[model samples]
Target chain A: EPEVTQTPSHQVTQMGQEVILRCVPISNHLYFYWYRQILGQKVEFLVSFYNNEISEKSEIFDDQFSVERPDGSNFTLKIRSTKLEDSAMYFCASSEEVGRNQPQHFGDGTRLSIL
Target chain B: GESVGLHLPTLSVQEGDNSIINCAYSNSASDYFIWYKQESGKGPQFIIDIRSNMDKRQGQRVTVLLNKTVKHLSLQIAATQPGDSAVYFCAENRLTGNQFYFGTGTSLTVIP
Candidate 1:
C-alpha cells in the first residue's frame, strides 16, 4: 500500500532553534495534514493543506507554525523558535481526496525533542 | 468544540477473545468517524471508518458501529491476537471543516 513517509525518525534541538519537518505524501494523495501527540495525550490537529494552500488550521497552529507544499510531492512543517513545550511526536498524514469518507493514512512520525 | 474522547482508558482481553472499544463525541455536526491503532512508537494507523449515513461498517477482523443520535462510536475486534495490543483512537470529522479531532485513545492489552 502507498504510505506517507516522514524524514528523521527523531530530532533533537535547542529551545530557540528553528526546525523543519519533512513529509512525502502518497503520490496520488490530494490532501495533506500535520498532527502532533504529546506524551500520553490525544492527537492534536495542527494544519491541513490542499491545492498548495492551507485549507484549515488549529489554534495550536499559531505564528510559530507554518506548512508548505514546496513541490508536488513534498510537504513540510516549519516551527520557528521552537519552545520546550514543542517537544512531541509530529505525524504527517494524507488522503487520496477530500471527502467525509476518505481515510487519512499516517507516517511513522518524527519525535521532536527540544532541550 | 471538536473534541473526541474515549470512554475507557484501558482494557484487557485474552488472546482469541473479542475486544470492544468505545468512543464518544460532543460535536453533533461530525459526519465522518475513523478508528486508528497505534503502537508504542508508531503513528496512528487507520483501521476502519464509518460515515454518518451508515451505522455499521466492517473490515477484515474489525467492525465499527456509529450512533449519530447519541454521538457514540465503537470498534470491535474479533478473535483478538497479541498483535492487537495497542492504543486505539477514534477521530471525528465534520462537514463544516476538513480537520479531524482525535480521541484520547484506549489502550488494549491481549493476554496470551
Candidate 2:
C-alpha cells in the first residue's frame, strides 16, 4: 500500500540551531499533519496543513515552529530555534480527505535529538 | 481540558487467547474514534475506527465496541498472536474538525 515517508530518520542538532523535518505524504492525499511523541508519551498534534495553509495548530506549536508545503509533494516543518524539550519522534500523516470516514495514515517518523 | 485515556497501562494475554483494550474520552463532541497499534520504533498504525452512530464495528479478527452513553471504547482482538503485542492508543476527533486527540496508550504483551 502507498504510505507516507519521512526523511532523515534521525536528526541531531545543537540547541539554538534551526532544524527542518521533511515528509512526503501519500501522493493522492489532500490533507497533511504533523504530530510529536515525547518518549513514553502519547502522540500530540502539532499542526495541520491543507491547500498550502495551516488549518489548525496546538499550543505546543509556538512561534518557533512553522510548516510549509514548498512543493506539491514535500511538506516540511522548521523549528527556528531548537530546545532540549523539542527532542522527540516527529510523525507525518496524510489523509485522502478530511472527514469522519477518512483516517490519517502516518509515517515511521523522524527522531529529533537536540544537544 | 477534555482528554482521551486508557483504562490500564499494560495487559498480558496468552497466544490464541482473546484480548480486549479499553479507552474513555471526556469530550462529548468527539463523534469519531480510532484505535492504532505501534510496534517498537514505529509510528501508530491504523487498526480500526468507529463513529458515534454505530455501537459496533468488526474487521479481520478485530472488533471495536463503542458505548456512547458512558463515553467508552474498546478494541477486542481474537486469537491474539505474538505479533499482536504492541502499544495501542485510542484517538478521538470531531467530524467538523481535522485534529485528533490521542490517549496515552496501553502496552499489550502476548506471552508465547
Each prediction's TM-score against the native? Answer: 0.95, 0.96
Per-structure clash totals for the candidates: 0, 0
Give model 2's clash tally: 0
Candidate 2 chain A: worst-modelled 10 consecutive residues by lDDT? A96-105
Q: What C-alpha RMSD does candidate 1 show over the true interface residues after superposing them?
A: 1.1
Top DockQ prediction, candidate number: 1
Docking class of 1: medium
Each model's lDDT: 0.90, 0.91
Q: Which runs of model 2 end up more than 4 angstroms from their true locations?
A: B1-7
Deviation of model 1 at B54, angstroms:
1.0
Q: Which stretches of candidate 1 lie over 4 Å from their true place?
A: B1-7
- RMSD in Å for all candidates: 3.2, 3.2
